[model samples]
Target: MVPIFVIAGIAIGMAAFVLLIQMAVRNGIRMSGLIDWRTQYELERIDDADGGKPTLHELYEIAAKTDSAPDAIERNVRAKALDYIESRNSIHVRNCWIVIGVAVGVCFLAMIITLASSPM
Candidate 1:
């Protein structure tokens, strides 16, 4: 029926929107961590002479070599950075779950509507 098709179309569109929002949130969380890590570690200076930035693995190696056993200031900064990153990640994950829940609910509603409107 037309109503069932309309409901399904709307549900599909909303599900796609929810997925896009989840992806954006996930990417934003990752990018925020990357930016914070780069700033905290002065990763710009770790680049090759040809101006190529180091890969994440290389950056980890550099950090391992340089950042052993935190001093007082370093310890405080590390703790704060970790707290910020964790909070951001948690918030993003929560939002993603909400979107996923909505998508699933929409699909369920569409299915119910479709079945109810169909002839036996």
Candidate 2:
């Protein structure tokens, strides 16, 4: 019975981990065409969303509105968006990992209690 509980706990933990990954993948939709997964980290610092850095797209739009050259603004927006996507995605992934870890712990605890209660 203990082994059964342990196995069940393990299965639940693995499922939670997979669920976390799925959530991360789903969140990638926010980047849509703005980011390609391969080169996202190069465009912006993932550690610094609050770095007061204006998004490239926002800069581009603002500059274009102010009669500045459009080309650089467009390029920067695309690059910045890519960076944002990468950084945000990484954050999501980290959060999910933590969630999975917690879920595993909880499942294990539940399993232990369950097995302890079970008897011939």
Candidate 3:
């Protein structure tokens, strides 16, 4: 009976987390594609309704370069700039995912330990 309650609580918590993510997504959409994935804030590029134009590349895609570089990122071709942004953004996104994975793993481990140790 205790295990049943514990499982039900976990389910409810997970459902709440899903709901929170959905709310974040809705809010971001309402606010210029700005999303905070509980780890960091990232801008999501949304193209125009007709698929003719995307949001300005400068809005979301900032070129990553060293401070010592003499070359102006602005001089680079649009494609190259976009590529650099994608790579940089991917690094942030990958870290976010890893953090999420670690969190979930820790939670799972805690749950197992709690259940195993419980006399009920």
Off by over 4 Å in 2: 1-21, 24-59, 65-67
Candidates in order, TM-scores: namely 0.53, 0.51, 0.38
What digit string (tens of lDDT, one per residue) describes model 3 on residues 1-120? Answer: 656756765765576567556645544453432433211222323311233333444422344332233254444434443553455456545544655565476557657766886887
lDDT of 1: 0.59
Q: In candidate 1, residue 44 scores what lDDT?
A: 31
Task: Compare the candidates by lDDT and give the number of the best one.
Answer: 2
lDDT of 1 by residue, 1-120 (tens): 758576676868676686867677655756565566535333333322444444445645555676775464455455544554455556557767776677677767777777777789
What would you estimate as the lDDT of candidate 3?
A: 0.47
Native-to-model Cα distance after best TM-score fit, residue 33 in candidate 3, in Å: 8.1
Q: For all candidates, what are the clash counts?
A: 0, 2, 0
Identify the superior model by lDDT, candidate 1 or candidate 2.
2
